[model samples]
Target: MPLTVHQFPCLEDNYGFLARDEATGLAACIDTPEAGAILKALDTLGWKLDLILNTHWHPDHAGGNAEIKAATGATIVGPAEVTRISALDREVKGGDVVMLGETRFEVIETGGHTLGHIAYFDAADAIAFVGDTLFALGCGRLFEGTAEQMWTSLQRLAALPDETTVYCAHEYTASNARFALSVDDDPALKARADHIFALRERGEPTVPTSIGLEKATNPFLRAPRLAERVGVAGEPDYKAFGAVRAAKDVFKG
Candidate 1:
């Protein structure tokens, strides 16, 4: 069965919470930004949260853990390195699968925005909680990890089925779209940008983009696609991955 996922806004400029399955009484909150937001969301949906999944140890993402746990008694599951930082109830790494009720999720390590950052994928639902690693039309900034590392992380994600719906942590599509336009001349992106612009203008979200959509319009996802789109002279080196990374770093939009 395809598990249904819901997103709830949290914190300020960049936080989101996800809820899956209400009838099973099974729900997972991805990146608990504030205890109140999570609590309110659960209350609004009449849902009981059974697990709290953290993508990284960033305070904005995990700050509500202790309080939420106290209130809901939900187990906090996250990357092993986040244990000290997030005080996780369950420490897991790559290749681990989490079974919550009738749904299953696989963990994919995406060490870029943070060295220990990871993304959870529900093969059954074709949905992903990518956190800061992969954003719409762009990739996460190299913080604790290198440009190469971020590039590698995106590749792992890009390799997923084209239909996978990406659920990133932030609403950075407008800015990312601007940068994507600067890096690649795709009429498709221009159309997407206009559509996204209107969506934002109307106070709508431009996320939950399909992997195929990102594969076609996102710049970071276009490294290999660029080679196919345009020769662009001397761009076929093995480091073409890094080439796109470097371009995005310098892109001024």
Candidate 2:
């Protein structure tokens, strides 16, 4: 059976995801952005949360671990770094598989925005829960890792099947699209930006972007192709990516 994902906006810009396995009805919250919101959603859906999956130790991501666990008794599972912020019941890493009933999530090491950030992929369903690593038109900032590390992590995600559905943890697409236009002139990107703007204008969410869409239009993913524009001509691929990331850091748009 497929995993049913319930996505809701939480915090100021973050999103909360509740994924349930249809076969066994076991559910997991991808991250704990807001405790009250998550608990409310669970109550409304009447779905029992079996796990609290943390992507990193950021306050917004794992801050609700204690509260949610106290309320639901769900096991908290995530990378070891989550211990920096909250208690973890299971320490998962790359190559590890976590099962919520019969649904399986393959953990991918995506350490860039944070040294121990990870993503969960369900190959059977082509769904990925990428927390603060890769976004719709951008990638995470090099907060604790290096350009090479982030670039490599992105490559790992890019290697996934093109049809994969990526569920990023935030709604920064409009701003990211603006920055993308400043760097790349891809017609596809222009069309995507227009669509994204229209979606936002209608008060819609711009997440759950596909890997194929991002591969074609995301500026960070297209960094190597835009080396000269970013002033990283003849540099390594990671360097080109670094230049684009640096540009975005100060982008007023």
Candidate 3:
């Protein structure tokens, strides 16, 4: 059976995800951005949380670990770095498999926004819970890692099957689309941005983007082709990605 994911907004643009393994009715919280919201959702759904999966140690991502654990006694599973902020019952790294009921999530190392950031991929269902690493039309900033590291991390995600459904942790698509339009003149992106703007105007969430959609329209993923626009002409793909990241850091539009 496929995993059922319930996404809800919480805490200033962040999203809280509750994934349920249908076969066993086991549930897991992708990241605890807000305890109250997560708990309320769990209560409303009447689903028991079996695990708390942390992608990193960022306050918004793992800050509610203790509170949620206290409320539900859900075992926490995440990269070792999460201990910097919350309790981790199991330390998972890349290549590790985490089973929630019969659904198996393959841990992927995506250390860019944070040194130990990780993503969970359930291949059977083509679903991925990507913390802050890869966003729709954008990617995470290099807070504790290098541009090269971020680029590599993105590659790991981009390599996933195009049909994979990506669950990113924020609702930054509108802003990211604005920045993307400023850099790439690809018609595909222009159309996608228009769609995104319309979605936001309707107060709709523009998440759960697919890997194929992002690989085609995301500016960061298309950085190599836009090397000249970002002033990294003739540079390697990673360098082009770095230049694009730098440009986004200061982009006012």
Ranking by TM-score: 2, 3, 1
> How many clashes does each candidate structure show, in the order listed?
0, 0, 0
Cα deviation of 6, candidate 3, in Å: 0.3
**In terms of lDDT, which candidate is strongest?**
2
Clashing pairs in 3: none
Residues 1-253, candidate 1: write the lDDT tens digits: 5566777667665756656663476888888877887788788887778899999888878888898889989999999767656687788777999877778889999998899999999987788889988888877777788766777788889899998988888888988888777767889999999999999899888777888898888877777666543344455432465567666677776
1-253: candidate 3 lDDT, tens digit per residue: 9999999999999999999999999999999999999999999999999999999999999999999999999999999999999878999999999999999999999998999999999999999999999999999999999988999999999999999999999999999999999999999999999999999999999999999999999989999999998888999999999999998999998
TM-score of 2: 0.99
Clashing pairs in 2: none
TM-score for candidate 3: 0.99
Number of colliding residue pairs in model 2: 0
Model 1 poorest 10 in a row by lDDT: 229-238
Sort every candidate by lDDT, greatest first: 2, 3, 1
Model 3 per-residue lDDT at 217: 95
Off by over 4 Å in 2: none
